[model samples]
Target: MKACISRWASEPFRVFFPLGMLAAIAGVMMWPLLYTGKLGFYPGEAHSRVMIEGFMGAFVIGFLGTAFPRLTGNASWSCGELVWMILLWATTVASALNGQVLVADTVFATLLLLLSSGMIGRWACGNRDTPPPGFVMALAGILGGALAAGLLAWNQKYPLGFTSYQFAKLWLNQGFLLLPLMGIAPYLLPRFFGMESGHSFHDSPTPPPGWWPRFTASVICALLIAAGFALEAFGWSLVGHVLRATVILAWFASETPVFRRGKLSCTPGNVARFAVVALILGTAAAGLWPLARVGSLHLFFAAGLGLAVLAVATRVVLGHGGRHDLLVGRIVWLRIAAGLLVLAAATRMTSDFVPAVRVSHHIYAAWIWAAGGSVWLIFVSRYLGRGEEEPS
Candidate 1:
């Protein structure tokens, strides 16, 4: 028992946790949107989103624990922090899932508040190599906690002085989840195409193939996303438009090095190439702005999240695992899987936009999401076995 506990306390467990969380996220995404006709579960939209929120909290904890050492030259965080953080996350997830259990829900929400605040406070001492845009982003975790608190209010006749439409709903949605993700996400963006990562696979800071100015451009992309999401939440819709446009440009700019180097045909290389195209098309859709309607958001997700993020996560995992010394093997199919996810998202998007498509939304969403989830799982396994070439 002691031996098992000791083994579990180490890095492999840490790695596996995020994989599990990501899988859960994919499952939550794919889960059927059924209805009991009850106010809460009728469309089941909130249920899925809340579950995704749980996965996000897990990702944040895992990300911070994994990345902080690389960035700050600190020792990996102690086991105690992991226990506390994960427990808090679990509680928060439970609270969201079972809002009727008022005591459990309230306790869990408070735990999230405490844990998230502690995370920001601990990282308060961190100094940045770049301008540290992620710092403010990370601080938004406290806001997420507040959102969790808002969720708990469903039990108390909704009498917390925060109405669902007002402070409880929209602000919490944007402030808590989207904003802090902005910080850690910059570190995460490059992985989709087997690029440089802090994942301990590639020797430290060695630039990936097919790129000259990937680093600078990646920073710009991250900043654009941060500003876009933040301004959108703050109700500065025009500013959101400008920031999103900047993201489109930055996305294209980041890929210039890849296109120039011309390895653009290899499996992983092609994924990055395709991602750039997706972004370009996505940006054109964005040109429609509010006139663009929800269909445009689907295009954005399909292109940006599905194509780009899929490439980033898989590629980063591969590079960090050290799988591509001569060349990273055929991971392009994974991107295809991601594209399938986009296809699924696009279906729902079409339904949202065109009344004719609404009837098939649930079934369409599930299949595409399953494909995306499966491919990501494949990457996780591939990296675990043979991905890491050298320890940094």
Candidate 2:
């Protein structure tokens, strides 16, 4: 038992990635149960927390724990770091399950802060190479999430009279999740497309000539997102989100040429690209149609977050396990999963637009969401623990 615990604890991704998927799957499943009056309590806020912070948070933790050391050329995270992560992750999940939002947020904030500190320390001590802009954005996103979590915890304690939950929500949803995505996607998407260094087999993308252009673009993107969120907080919801979504769409539009470069079939690369489009569009939809925000929000979850997680998780599992072929292969099931998620997103969005079909749509969306996660776990989980690249 000790050995088993030690094994999982040492490998952050191995322990957290599957758990994250499970949480996401369970969260989706619960939504339908809530709608059907089958469940006594439906912690909608808690459900969002688990899906976004819990599910994506786990993947982020695992990825950072695995990748940060490599990028910084720093020593692998200590056993102490892994142990703390496990303890905190377990506690946070428990708190979330029990509807202890404050507790979960506080723990998550601490974890983010700790991880950020470690990475910053390593950057300070290690070689003087300028870090990737995407990486910088990601670190900033982590800190931003920490601040949001801290604020949420404070609100719980001090009882800030006004409703600031939306602010916290935006910060986590856009600032924490989107900014880092902007930073990393440029670098990773190219690799996924087999466009890096104009070669397919290279494990990493060839760094762009002079990171300044990408850095400048990243900074602008972050500023636009931040501004949009700020506007939303200040009661300019439509204007703010429209502006934000426009920027995202424009930025993504700029990347369309890359997608056009090759056969745009049902490949993982296209799935990822589609995920980006869905994310931007969903964000815009949420802003434009306020009444349909719930539906649009689920669209973001199912197509945006859900599909992207599937793509990246598969890549990590395969790349790390020395099975890049399977990772990049034209796997039919992967396409089917992506299609199901798209269906889920459509069902969710329509739930708001058409009242008559709401209940049925919710049920459809929930099952489709669960199906997507199930496909991933069945196929991808097997490869996750195969690699011991990260040290124990």
Error of 2 at 93 (Å): 1.8
True-vs-predicted CA distance for residue 371, candidate 1, Å:
2.7
- Candidate 2 lDDT over residue span 57-107, tens digit each: 888888777777766556767677888987887777778766788898899
Give each model's clash number: 12, 0
Error of 2 at 63 (Å): 1.4
Off by over 4 Å in 2: 1-11, 35-38, 161-165, 197-209, 253-258, 263-266, 388-392
How many backbone collisions does model 2 have? 0
TM-scores of the models, in the order given: 0.64, 0.89
Off by over 4 Å in 1: 1-40, 43-45, 94-239, 251-295, 301-303, 306-309, 319-329, 385-392
lDDT by residue (tens digit), candidate 1, 135-163: 34555544554555547455366555433
Error of 1 at 357 (Å): 2.7
- Among all candidates shown, the one with the greatest TM-score: 2
Which 10 consecutive positions of candidate 1 have the poorest summed lDDT?
197-206
